[model samples]
Target: MAQGKLERTGFWPGDARLVISISMQFEAGAQPERGASGPFPPLDPKYPDLPMQTWYDYGVKEGIPRMLDLWDRVGVKVTSHMVGQAVDRHPQLAREIVERGHEAAGHGQTWEPQFSMTPAQERAGYLASIASIERATGTRPIGFNAFWLRGTPNTLGILQELGFVYHIDDISRDEPFTVPVNGKPFMVVPYTLRNNDIVRYDSPALTVDAYLADLKAEFDLLYQEAGRRRRMMSISTHDRISGTPARVRALETFIRYAQSHPGVRFMRKDEIARFALTAPGVPRS
Candidate 1:
């Protein structure tokens, strides 16, 4: 067996030092419902997961508005990975995202895992997700961030067939690169959980201060490297996680710090995808 290496590509728009993308996950109704079908069994016999559902609803009711205001203040365009059912439930929210000039990228029909689905099932889900989002936002997404960022072997091919220009299912590279699908190049815009607010829920050690500090350190290194060899950084957030009052401050602080640096450009995922697809100096798959 042999190993494959991902070479760094010093390419980006406007020859900027670094490309920073703020990715927000809006998965309200898309989350697994109580007693809903999934690869795993329900924790309790209930019709709706009241506790979890309300937590997710808070994002739509308060979290999203607060985050949007912060982003507006920061003057950064973010890419939102939304679930179809969530969009359907909150059509106005979906429209608000587009009207705000942010990019809406696909997540899935629901937050369920895709790896367990058969090829046929995955493809069907993918199509339904695309259609639902388009119906809500009036624009078909050009990029996809699979549920929990998990994807099956068929994800990329299906994405390519469905006209997606890029995918963020990979965290292997800090910079954008190409992966061949159907003998055609597909852009892989890397995503990371390193700076995501979901960490607050999963890890007790990752405090708001810790998350802010980590973001600053990550941005500093990337900004420096980007000077010589253009770099890109992805900051993943959630409406439900980063939308809270305290957590939102951390996100706001990081964006402010990143903005203070020179030659740092904020971009949407679709913008990154198009750049990688058409930019010079980017290596082919």
Candidate 2:
């Protein structure tokens, strides 16, 4: 029940601080494929808006555990956006998440599309995703991050109606904001594509050094500006992309380097949302 006020709205962080929230989207085989051999069936472009990975074949079987090990080695807890289809394929993955002490929230049942759908369609998609996650994990997912970047009208309302605590579909700005959903300011944890390792997907060299340098630069700037701005840095990652050995090595180095700075707190999105609800203007817990 910890809540923080927004600097512009009411509260402001007096301390110069930064929160590092790492988002690792766990899809065993949920990534969309450009070819027919995309690991799973064809991507669902209609209601669910699913990706092209054979989630069950890859993620649950080998992907999640591997990523978990990487996080564990670094002593970092991730906010894993669980894809339901993969969950159904690898049910014990949920148990493992709970056992390992990470937050398992919704990434949609199958990592599908709900952003451009009609209100009813979007609502249906949300509900279906939520139920599937809850049934499989025994913990109702409260955080949602859509597969595609698209967000729809009434999305927050629907999320709150279904008892979600936070959502990360928007990147309109760099900082977290509150949406007045259902009369209360529901938490919006801002996510960014910059800190993600996916940026290296099309790069020429595709080396971990590039990723580390970029991540270090972002954290360095944010850490220095801790006084002027209440900041949180999020690194968006995936199994097939960031889960690889090279990227993980880069991530490990950056995490250690960032931790060297004083007052850099690392927590899940739920923890940030809880803090935001209580201490809006404050730098962070």
Candidate 3:
């Protein structure tokens, strides 16, 4: 199979050597009680997992605010992938995310999977999420990310119909690309798991220092490569994960390190999508 690549002639705006996109996931209180448990045995749906619930609660009560402060102090903007129900539960925090110069993109109505839903159910979920985010933030989210990065075959078509301009579920490329959905161009800003905080759980032996080292290594290579072709480095953080003090400190360090280099810019996913729409050679197979 042939692979599609963004044109090397010119890529990001201002001829930047590299663009770094930060994703702050806000889905703590919106998660299903049984999904993604932490250090707890399986419990019946009839019973609530109190500890797990409160663990997620920490993200709301502490994580989001700490992360917001970090972004404010560092003078960088990020995209917050917010769950609709989560935003509804804390509209004030959602508003603050937008007020602090961050983009609020849709994650879903809740933290449950949408892939199993029928097309009608999926469409309804998308509609509900769009309404919730718009109601809270006063700006309709034009980008969508599915729960657990899982989406059904009908996901793109439904998102396009609902007026979303882009999605980040795709991880096939480092740069944003366009895919034809419903016979029109829809953008895909590829996400990353390599630089994601979830890896800490995926590999319990990993330390925060190791994680920071990985981020720097990834950035170093991409920054070097971007001299010839456009490159974008995506760092994924969650309110329950990277929003903690130690992890967020590592994140702050990485951001400042990136800033030290010339011609590197931090961009929101929407900004990347809009640029991909106009850039040449951004079509994917």
Candidate 4:
């Protein structure tokens, strides 16, 4: 596929120096009990990992609420990638996300891989996820993020046929770009693993200060690069990972640090995709 690029002179809305897109994952109850990541290996499939299951449950009971409060305090909106089964189990929380003025994007029916599925099964999975988010939030999601950021050859075409405007599985660029999916335009707002909470806090377990420093460093470089052309910084957080008090504090500090700059704006991924599609000098092939 031919990837689109913006002209060197292009700028974001209002000519902002840097646009920060924040993604908050909401996939607590949707994952299978046997494959969860924790300090120890998961138990055999024959036995239920009750402790591990509750670890994810914390995301629903405490993590999400904490993150929501932090965003409210900072006056920044984010995109919450809601899994279908999780939304169905907690429709009120799903509705509350939209009510609070954040975008609800599909993250699949369950936190399972889709790359190995047949094309028909993948299509059905996408459809079911979209329907679940729509039913719970009263707003259909136009953006999708596959579980584990994996996609098959048929992923883009299926998404376009299902009327999705964009997907976040691509990590090839720092800014939004479009590619042809069955001869129609589909947007790819790239996601990042470098700035992901799961990678930093959950696995390697970086210190709060270290995590904050990394975020600021990333923003600093991108802010400088944006002076020449459009640049976007993607920061990812999970309900079960970055929602803890210490990690959330680090995230809030990083946000404030970025805000102190002259021309850094936090935007939702959908907003970024739409702006890129219409922005001058952005290729739309």
- Per-residue accuracy of model 2 over 161-255 as CA lDDT, tens digit each: 88888899877655677878767778889888787655555465756786788888888887766545767888888666676666667788888
Residue ranges of candidate 3 with Cα displaced over 4 Å:
1-9, 34-36, 44-46
Q: Is candidate 1 or 4 superior in lDDT?
A: 4
- What would the per-residue lDDT of candidate 3 be over residues 1-285, giving only the tens digit for each residue? 234534353668888889999999998768786645665667876887788888788888999899999998888899999999999999999999999999999999976688898999899888899899989999999998997789999999999988899999989988888889988889999898888876554577888899999899999999878876778999899888787899889988999999999899999999999898888777665
Please list the Cα RMSD from the true structure of every candidate, rounded to 1 decimal place.
5.2, 6.5, 3.8, 4.3
lDDT of 1 by residue, 70-182 (tens): 98998999999988888988989988988898998988887678888888888888888889888888899988988768888988998888888999988888888899898
Cα lDDT for residue 18, candidate 2: 78
List clash counts for every candidate, in order: 0, 30, 0, 0
Give Cα-based local distance difference scores for all models.
0.82, 0.71, 0.87, 0.87
TM-score on alpha carbons, each prediction? 0.90, 0.82, 0.94, 0.94
Q: What is the lDDT of residue 283 in candidate 1?
A: 62
What lDDT does model 4 reach?
0.87
Give the Cα RMSD of candidate 1: 5.2
What TM value does model 3 have?
0.94
Lowest-sum lDDT 10-residue window in model 4: 1-10
In Å, residue 240's CA in model 1 sits off its true spot by 0.6
